[model samples]
Target: MILVVLGTHELPFDRLLKKIDKQILLGNINEEVLVQAGHTKYYSKNMQIFDFTTYEHMADLYRKANFIITHGGTGSITMGMKMGKKVIAVPRLIKYGEHNDDHQLEIVKQFQETGHILYWSEPMSLSEVLRLVKSFNPVKFESGNKKIISLIKQFIDGA
Candidate 1:
């Protein structure tokens, strides 16, 4: 199963949903699709979508998913990454009115650069990215909190 996550941002992210719907229509995606649609109001026969669900239910869905297609919010991306799931992140562009700003691009690019996730963007179709997923190996997720704590402890001891 593929899980699509659009986090609880106020803006509608119909753009991403439309692309996924198209891919499903094209038969590029042959698996069951479940979506946490958030504010995006879209109807698709190819997917099982809900506006929201309990945290535990969401986590269960995440665990059952073979891979994840997500909006470029930090929480959504990191959750999949932290679980060792393959993540394909699409940034919501302000020009499309999907977000108030293009800040999502920054985090998406950072994660992509670090080899934690694949990203879908212009000049590359979702099908193209999906083809690459067969061989994509994501780097294991590691939290930065431990390093930050160590640095703070060192500073205090040195003082």
Candidate 2:
């Protein structure tokens, strides 16, 4: 099963959803698709979708997912990576009215550069990504949040 997550952002990421839907319609995706649509209003016969989901439900889906398709949210990407799942990160771009800026693109790029995830920035065929996944070996994500924790400690100590 392929799990598609749009996160809980206010802006709707119908762009990514549409692409996935298209691929499913074209018979490129034969597996079952589960979507956490968030604010995106999309209807697809090829996918099982929910407007929102509980944390427990989300965690269950994560565990069951073979590969994850997600918006470029650090939390979602990190969670999927930490689970050792193959992740495809698609940034929510400003021009598409999916975000206020292209910051998601940068996040996607950084993750890709570090071998943390695969990123698809522009409109393209997901078939290529699907094929790549068979041979793709994603690097395990190592949390680098200790620096922030140290900064917080310094501030608390008035250092």
Candidate 3:
């Protein structure tokens, strides 16, 4: 089971949902899908759509996924990385009207280059990424956020 999260950023990314099997669209597109002009229906043959959910639901879904396909949101990616789950970070490009900037592209690039994650843009590469995900190993991370704790201490001490 793969979890595909399209963040709640007022973007229509339902197009990508059709490509995967047994996926859940993590956003508020329930009756408002593809027919924002006042129509009410969104039935994709491949995926199930969730209008909205709580953080616990999100965490539960994340824990159960064999792989993850999500936007380049820091929270989502960080969660996936911390769990060492196979992930495909697709940036919401401005051309696609998914984002206001291309920062996601650069962010995903840096994460990929650092061997922390994998990213896909093209449909063909997405297929390949799907195949490759099963074999990708997530790096081991510390149990506690020591670096952030240290940073906060530095700020408190005015260091």
Per-model TM-score versus the true fold:
0.97, 0.89, 0.76
Q: For model 2, what is the error of residue 124's alpha carbon versus the real structure, in angstroms, after optimal superposition?
A: 4.2
The parts of candidate 2 lying over 4 Å away from their true place are 145-159
Ranking by TM-score, best first?
Answer: 1, 2, 3
Better of 2 and 3 by TM-score: 2
lDDT of each: 0.92, 0.89, 0.66
Single out the weakest 10-residue window by summed lDDT for candidate 1. 119-128
Q: Evaluated with TM-score, which candidate comes out highest?
A: 1
* lDDT of each residue in 43-66, candidate 3, tens digit only: 664455665678787888888877
The pairs that clash in candidate 2 are none
- Name the better of 1 and 3 by TM-score: 1
Residues 1-159, candidate 2: write the lDDT tens digits: 999999999999998888888888878888999999999999888899998878888988999999999999988998899999899999999998999999989998999899878888676557787778778899987776998898899999995
Q: List the residue pairs that clash in candidate 1.
A: none
Model 2 worst lDDT window (10 residues): 121-130
Error of 1 at 12 (Å): 0.8
